[model samples]
Target: MQIRTNALVSSVKNFLIEVGGIIDFTVLVFKQFFKKPREHKEMIKQAYYAGNKTFPLIAITGFIMGLVLTLQSRPVLVEFGAESLLPGMISVSIIREIGPVITALLCAGKIGSGYGAEIGSMRVTEQIDAMEVSGINPVSYIVASRIMATTIMVPILVLLADAIAIYGSYVAVNMYSDVNFQLFYNQAYNTLSFKDLIPATFKTIIFGFMIGLIGSYKGYYSKRGTEAVGAAANSAVVTSSLAIFVIDLVVVQVTELF
Candidate 1:
């Protein structure tokens, strides 16, 4: 009984710590965002690195996701003789849920972890200290830029992912049935409304914020030595993934209530 109680207390303590960390990180990012903008060159370079360079991975992942979703969904749809709805169903799922969520998860694994390790390493090596000594605002240069870059780039990536996923769905559709390009797209678009598009896109912005916030927070506060860098990276991914789900739940509930 004592052991179980101790375990429960530990879990709660860990949860609270994570929540506090998230809040602190968010405050720091926002504070930095509103501060005098410095390091434009560094910020731009980071944006290109974080955003442009991530495109290939995002595209490939998006393609495979659509293809697999369609391929797997076919038999189920066929059973209902609703294969005609393939494009529409896939499109809704992709745009409304899969595209943004999957893209964010991928980003969490790739970009989130990258940010954590990179910054954590800097912290471990006292590069951050050197920056302060050199009269550089490390928060604005590192955290603000990353947060801004993720915010700006994630939505764009989701849009591209949506398009590529649709194309992939088209290919998957053709494997078992014939669908003209125009007709397929028409069917797909006919089912989508501003309602689905707006909410999904909005949620993605939150997802991006969470990813950047968590990654930057872990890295910024990391302790110990080089090993802390790896730990920060790992924790950032794990926590950001959880944050995505938690935020999604709330978003969905709120959307439904509205």
Candidate 2:
């Protein structure tokens, strides 16, 4: 019993220590964000990777999400004679929650792992150290730019995914009844308000920030080795995914109160 207790305590202590380290790292990145010689070109490059490179996967995922959801839910709603509400139901679900969450999780897996491996390799190669010795701020040029890229691109990706998902839902709806595009569009549009869109988009920005920050953090502090690069990539994916769910829960609860 004592051994188990000690193990648990040690684990918690290490976790908290790592959390504190992440906070400090985040502060350093933020401080560098405002410093001179803004890394606009790097930021844009990161954004392109985060957004354009990730879009095809998101497009397929979003379409499947909407199609599967509509197909699964349609039968139940049809039984309850609520089939008319299908468009609104799907719109609310995809836009208000599913779209953002799915996009963020995908980004966490792809962009987060990419960031970690990329930076971890740099660390292993001593590139970051070389940059520091050359009077270059790694935090500013690398971390801040990547974080900003994720912050800007993830939300845009989420929005694009939401649109694609809705179109896919419309396609699914047509598989059964001959619902007109205009009618489906009206139904979906009417059900959505600024309240739904704004909060969802806001949470996605937070999701993006977390994904980038956690990935960068893992890579930036990774142990110097080839094995450590893989470990950092895996750790970044796991941590960023967990952070997305936690942040989504908090955002939902806070949004409910407003």
Candidate 3:
């Protein structure tokens, strides 16, 4: 019994240490975030990779999500003979909850892992040290670029995904009962207020920042081993993914109070 208790306490201690370190790392990044960002061209390149490169994946996923959701929900709504409400219902769901969370999680997997591995490899190889020797800020150049890229791009991607998902729903709705394009769009937007849109978009920006920050933190402080590179990447995905759901819960709770 004592042994088990000690193990549990040890686990909690390690977890808290990790949380404290991440908080400090985030603060450092924020300090750099406000300054005139370095590597203007690098930020653009990172943005392209994080945002533009992600379009195809998001587009296809959004379409499938909309179509599948509509098809699945239609049968249930139809049971009540309320199939007409499909557009508004789906739009509400995709916009208010589904869209942002899905997009952020996808980014957590793809972008987060990439950041960790790239940064971790640099850390293990002494590249980050070399930058410091040259009087360069590795944290700002690499970490800030990624955090800002993801911070800026993820929201844009979420917007695009939300619109594309609505389009997919339109296609699905038409397959069952014809809906005029304008009417379908109008109904979709009608159910959405500033309350839904603003909070959802805002949370996604935070989500993006968290993903990039966590990934960068793991990589930036990685241990000096080749194996640490892969560990960083894996931990990036797991940690950022968990962070998404946690932030999502808080956002939802805060939105409810509004």
Q: Best candidate, TM-score-wise?
A: 2
- Deviating ranges (above 4 Å) for candidate 2: none
Q: For every candidate structure, what is the RMSD over all alpha carbons to the true structure, in angstroms?
A: 1.4, 0.8, 1.1
TM-score of each: 0.95, 0.98, 0.97
Which clashing pairs does model 3 show? none
Which candidate number has the best lDDT?
Answer: 2
Task: Candidate 3: count the clashes.
Answer: 0
At residue 192, candidate 1 shows an lDDT of 97
lDDT of the structure predicted as candidate 1: 0.89
RMSD to native, candidate 2: 0.8
lDDT agreement with native, every candidate: 0.89, 0.95, 0.92
> lDDT of model 1 at residue 179?
89
Model 3 scores worst on lDDT over the 10 consecutive residues at 33-42
Runs in model 1 lying further than 4 Å from the true structure: none
TM-score of 2: 0.98
Expressed as tens digits, the lDDT of each residue in 1-258 for candidate 1 is 999999999999998987887787788778877778665777678678778888899999999999999999999999999999999999999999999999999889988999999999999999999999998888898888887888777788888999999999999999988889999999999999988899899999998888888888899989969899999999999988988899888998888776
